[model samples]
Target: MRLDPPPTTPESEHRRRIGAVQEAMKREGFKLLIAYADCWRTANVRYFTDFRPVDGVHTIAQAVIALPAESDPTLFTGDGCLDYAASETAFDVAELEHLPLYLRRHLNADGRVALAGEEQIPVGLHRTIAEAIAPAPLVASNLLAKIKAVKSPWELEQLRHAAVLTDLGMEAVQQAVSTAGQVTERQLARAADVAMINAGADTPAYLSMVQAGPRSAFSLALPTNRVLERGDLVLTDIGARYGNYVADGGRGFVYGPPSGQAREIIDAAADAVEAGLAAARPGISAADLNGAIQAVLIERGYAEFSGEARGRGTGHGTGMDPEEELPWIGPTDHTVIEQGSVFTLKATINHPQVGGLRTERIVHLGATGLELLDTFPMRNFW
Candidate 1:
């Protein structure tokens, strides 16, 4: 069955978003905020004007959205006529060819301006905009990232729909792997990908991680043509995207019944994720939560298996991107977990004898407490 997302963010909510950013700019003394977006980081611009850049092949052309503290936001796209005709955008959109003229017209010579998506902006474009308003000085900031991390009601609903579709995809993969005596990893991945696409997702939320037996040791390994044995352990990491929001998490499975080591590692990872979930309420520091998760594994006598020893951290925020926006739940990050924040907590272990086992769950810090967004059962197999 296909699951659909709730109605997209309304025009009123878009106005509220613009107002919130303007308030933040006022406090920070920024006269204007210029945001950039490409196919990869489209959320930065989508937050202001519900417009996604056309997914062109072989090119990552950018679109710009300029939001002055006191004026209506204007969207500038290279394919101006196409986007203008296709997008039911709330604000005005003009050809990006006129960017230099627009910048010259609106920018104050000495006013402080901030740029969002600074890292994603191409070097040539940045230099052009930088040189256009030289004396004003373009300041690089993560203002939009911080603003977008907190989930609005509409965004939360979108995320929940995405997670439901992701669960459907995960279930399909689990069935594909468990029912087959010798299925290739690529075949299983294709099952999950096609399931999500059929369930109303724009695309697969992330690159599928489908590994069997020894290959599971690589946490982020891509799907391969390796055939799975009847008793092999299978690891599947998949998600789905709906209304620009992403769902992220995965589970492990055994082609048949799980072996002793496989069961033990999977149970230990579950214990760690459960511990993290209990401590995921608002006001906990990301570091403290990371510590809590690790403490469970250490208590279970897996002290030698430091998951973050690979240096990628246990988990991260999931929103516009599949990972890493805010409240980076790692060993050293001190970002305070806040209400309305949504993220994933993953626990993983790579053992010489047990291969790799991982369990992940998504959570939203509701007003009263934590809400589990994903409903998939954490079983060892279908």
Candidate 2:
């Protein structure tokens, strides 16, 4: 059965987010905060204005939210997005080309300004904006990201809806792979995409990934035409996006009975994910959480395939973006896990003989403990 869409973030919540960012800017001596967003990285602008750009080949959708410490925020986009932005967001709308004029009105030469999403801002645009606010000393800041790290009640509901959609997609993949015979990886991936869209997702959070046999050894490989065979290990990573929030999850499967090595690797990854979840209470450092998961892998004699050895973290925060920066669960990251944060706990292993196996789930750190957002069977042998 299809799930209904979650409650949309009200205009008040958007205002509150803007206020929070303004407060942070005031503390940091930033007189104006300019947040840039493109089609890909939209959290910063969307957080303030709730307007997500619709990108296209001719229209490289981009948006900017200019928030002055003392004044209301303005949302700027191309003429193509003007109507949509006006309808979706409760902010003053302007043409993107007029950004310099708007900035000149709100910014003073001696005041300090900060730019969010600095890394993704185009060089030409950045130079133009810098010149527009000349002598204002626009500097890079992570204020928006830090503030958005913790999910609000409204955002959490969106994420939970997304998680349910993602679970349905993964379940579709599991069912497709379990069919009698000759199912190709591409077919399985299609099954998942169709299931999620039919179930009311804005879109699959990312390309549905289905890798079987030797192809599964590549962590981020796209689906191919390789047909599944008996004794071959299969891995599928899929997610669903709803209400601008997203859920990322994955599962492993064996076409036939699993080999002893395959079983061991999958079990180790599952155990590591469980350990990570168990240790995900508030007040614990992300490093501690990663250590808990890594410890399980090491004890299972799969240290070489652990995230540390592979240079990938055990897990990451998830929300508007599929992968948020804060609470990066890794060996050296020391960010403390806070209540109300949501994350994707994942453990992946690759073996030359058996292939790659990954177990992932979306979770939220509630007041009590980590709450599993996605609920699907972890072990599958078809």
Best by lDDT: 2
lDDT tens per residue, model 1, 1-382: 8775446678888988899999999889998898988876677787876677766632225788889999898888765444542375888888776777888899889788899988888898888888877789899977777787788888888888888888888888877865776689899889988988888888887787888888877667898999987656677789888877888987877676777887777888888888888888768888888888877777776766646533356677787678746868888888788788889988877675567756888889887889999987665743
Give the per-residue lDDT digits (tens) of candidate 2, residues 98-191: 9999889888789898899888888888998999999889899978878888999888989998999998998888777766367899999999
In candidate 1, residue 296 scores what lDDT? 79
Error of 1 at 247 (Å): 0.4
Ten contiguous residues minimizing lDDT sum, candidate 2: 303-312
User: Which regions of candidate 1 are displaced past 4 Å?
Assistant: 57-60, 84-86, 298-311
Clashes of 2: 0
Worst 10 residues of 1 by lDDT: 79-88
Q: What is the lDDT of residue 205 in candidate 1?
A: 78
lDDT for every model?
0.79, 0.84
TM-score, one value per model? 0.92, 0.95
